[model samples]
Target: MSAAGGGSAGSIRIDRLLVYLRFARTRSAALALIDTHALRRNRKHVLRASEQVRIGDVLTIALGSGVRVVELLALPPRRGSPAEAASHYREVDSDGLDRKGQMTIGASSPAPGILSGDPEDFS
Candidate 1:
């Protein structure tokens, strides 16, 4: 396979991609999303779950109501904790905000849910 963007000799592999996908909690989600034609790499639609991914490559994954574009920065040989996995990729510039001026689905949200429930409700 061809390694573009100054990729390291051992950085191109499907397993590495899997590690990132799992880290993102999207391994199964991404696979199912791919089957529905909801995933793209470098702007081209990708259907294979085992396709090799390289550093600096852009991955656009279709979410509930929007898409997220993540730029690969490094490809490690094995999976690690959340913090370690986060270092594997970088959010691309165009990956933010949707065309409608709303926040992209994957962008961080203020703490989930409202704090209106009664404190005594919990055991």
Candidate 2:
């Protein structure tokens, strides 16, 4: 039995997770995002869309403008409301000051050579 308590296990496909968590608008979009090789799982680059992301996994996603890091809090059963989806993961704001009131290092710039917003680039 997985941590989710059911026999299905507490894991979801990375592509599906992206949509479920409102990160990617659709599965195809998620795949395109994945193709960029900019998404990282637990600090390791995610090379495929079929990879599994379990509860508590940390995901670092490079967006069009910046990178966002999130720690999985739960495995969403489905693509729910934004609020519900937001509940499944906690953002790890590395750019902000830490508890010690010191600057923490984080990816504050967009990924170089990765055209994130141009739909024409993916074609």
- What TM-score, computed on C-alpha atoms, does each candidate reach? 0.57, 0.71
TM-score of 1: 0.57
Please give the CA lDDT of all the candidate structures.
0.52, 0.71
Per-residue lDDT, model 1, residue 74, is 76
State which candidate has the highest lDDT: 2
Give the least accurate 10-residue stretch of model 1, judged by summed lDDT: 108-117
Residue 37 in model 1: lDDT: 64
- Per candidate, the number of residue pairs that clash is 0, 0
Candidate 2 — what's its lDDT? 0.71
Tell me the tens digit of each residue's lDDT in model 2 across 14-120: 88888777777777878877776758887777788888888878888877767777999998888787778889999888664134632222333333433343445
Q: Highest TM-score among the candidates is held by which one?
A: 2
